[model samples]
Target: MITLATSVFGIVLCKGEIIKTSVHGPTGKISYKDEGFGGMPVVFVHSFGGNVSHWDGIKDSLVQNRRVVRIELRGHGDSEFPKDGDYRISSMAKDLATVVNLLGLQRFVLVGHSMGGSVALQYAGENPSRVAGLVLVDSNGDPKKNPEEIRTQIKNVLFSDAYVETTETYWKQLLERSKPEVQERLFEELVRAPKDMVIKITSELLDYDPTLSLKRYVGPKLAIVTPENDDKFSLHRLQLGFPHKVIQNAGHWLQLDQPEAFREILETFLQRY
Candidate 1:
């Protein structure tokens, strides 16, 4: 696996590099990547079990005119994973706020995927004025989506020896099946994540409910749902309370599969806002 490092310049340097930086959260220090500082900062949050590299492809495009930041939330990626606590959505939301404060980011956009998407919603819900805009890509917001059977099944899959054996494929599921450009990077970051973080995050996801969070925010928020699911799921979620657009044919990892379309969506939203 490749170890990402940086010079004194930090993650948001003039050259394309992701510096290893750490910020203090309430519980502990959290690791993250920063790119293109000074302009409006765009903070990125990863899924249930994701590293900062998930946003690599879309980083440069966003960095051209804005500052891009990718945060490895507590218990995920290079961040500190404590052995106890609720690790609730609200707690993670506070962690995001701390990162923003540490970076002196007065206003910015928050884009999150899967679990990160839910965290973004919670953060927006708490601090509506601080958020410039919001983007939720294939995010899970309701606890009802996964029944007890599904949760236990996924928990078993994530913790089993088979998962460790087929870890490559497991991570690849988040990548687009059409484009095969990101193997090296994904392979490196996928295994770097701690297994306990994976399990606990799943546990938290199984109990998360962000409907109230979505309803609380009155800012520019876009939920990019996938078209792979049936019409019923899409209709139910869209009408649940937030406005969203569907990224056709793409699975949960819309950014990796359809970079251009995903970039288009972000640019349009940012421009409109």
Candidate 2:
């Protein structure tokens, strides 16, 4: 049992916190966090260049209403990296499926950000019934068709060498709104990603074409378009042929950039499901 004593910031954190323990994946352990109880479980997946803590800003709020979980994908945060070439979205989807099955959860919501959202989409596409709903935040549908320079600019953010040396404090500093120490601990445990996987994953992200993957996921999906530092929305609109909601004043990392707005938008969307 996990327990957390909290009344700070008017947030009620229950005892037995059930923090992210390791979930065995195909390659290795996939790290994740969990909290709250008595309602449907929801998993929040962070983006590239981000660990699951990115959702902490809004997690406590969500936990008030439902059991909320976040996962650190392979090669990021505390998760183990794949020694082989199994970082593709399909493989990642399988890893997530294993986690869900292990938890014995049924009828839960899947919330994913950026690349993590890509993995969620593919999974829901194939197993729509298993997913109660989906929340795709600042996600990219296709990058290969993007303007070469635009993709290049975002690439800088993804594979920044700064990501390796930068501690959790660095991420918090960069994010400016995150907890100083908790955020740092997550970064400290991240896999020492190899250069090859970085390049390969970049190719996978940019060229994998999540639009094709979306066609397979038939669940209720919400496309959250971040208005800043994100180009995936337009690409998604054009490629996936769906209408999306725009979050004003939000950047690439919308949850971090506009926590309250993100929380409001998320709750509003989830209410319908």
Candidate 3:
């Protein structure tokens, strides 16, 4: 039931009757889907190597009672790649700012997954007054914890001729606990991302210091993660004292792996905060 039309600006889709639109961002056109019209707006930013469709599993339920906006990061989905090859997290955060500004969202809840969590933190840190609440899903807050040797190894692999194969293996390992169908779909999306873009983003991400941003935003915060990440260092472990919930039997993409449970946890946060 998906219909599409071109309007000289970008392709607009009529899936579920939601109007898919685009905004002119710092790097290029940024595509996002806006729906619903009640309650505080809920803005979603998908993970690196993912598009807006990554939120499809839970967006409809949230959209029923709240204005929901899902933004696609540059170089992903319909968004154009940066002409200058700027894939830094801060630049991506600016892309988020562009869309939010265009929508005139003065205040709203921000939700981010994986790399998107970093972008959300950056935005909330810089514009703390605008974000009412912040949620980080399976995202790391201190990538600098990784030793230099490990990062060097990762960079070498990313620049090697076997980059695609190596990344495929890494993605598969992350989805080992997910459903077969979920694994298949997500793997395809992750592996298809432009190699150079992925490399640059990953390289910069290793050096990203989310602590400063996390300290700046003093809003209600929550970290939703899977059991596999329970032992890992994260914002939830910081002195910030924000709560975190671990969904059992779920993989990296907990929202897609356990949509109902993920939504319940998310709704609880929205309600309590």
Predicted structure with the largest lDDT when compared to the true one: 3
TM-score of 3: 0.93
Q: What is the lDDT of residue 76 in candidate 3?
A: 89
RMSD of each: 4.9, 7.3, 2.6
lDDT-sorted candidate list, best first? 3, 1, 2
Question: On residues 19-64, what C-alpha lDDT tens digit does candidate 2 reach at each position?
Answer: 6567667887777776877677888888765687788898887788
lDDT of 1: 0.73
CA lDDT scores, all candidates in order: 0.73, 0.70, 0.86
Residue 219 accuracy (lDDT) in model 2: 64
Q: What residue pairs clash in candidate 3, if any at all?
A: none
For every model in order, what is the number of clashing pairs? Answer: 3, 11, 0
lDDT agreement of model 3 with the native:
0.86
Q: TM-score-based ranking, best first?
A: 3, 1, 2
Off by over 4 Å in 3: 1-18
After superposition, candidate 2 runs with Cα above 4 Å error: 1-15, 146-194, 228-236
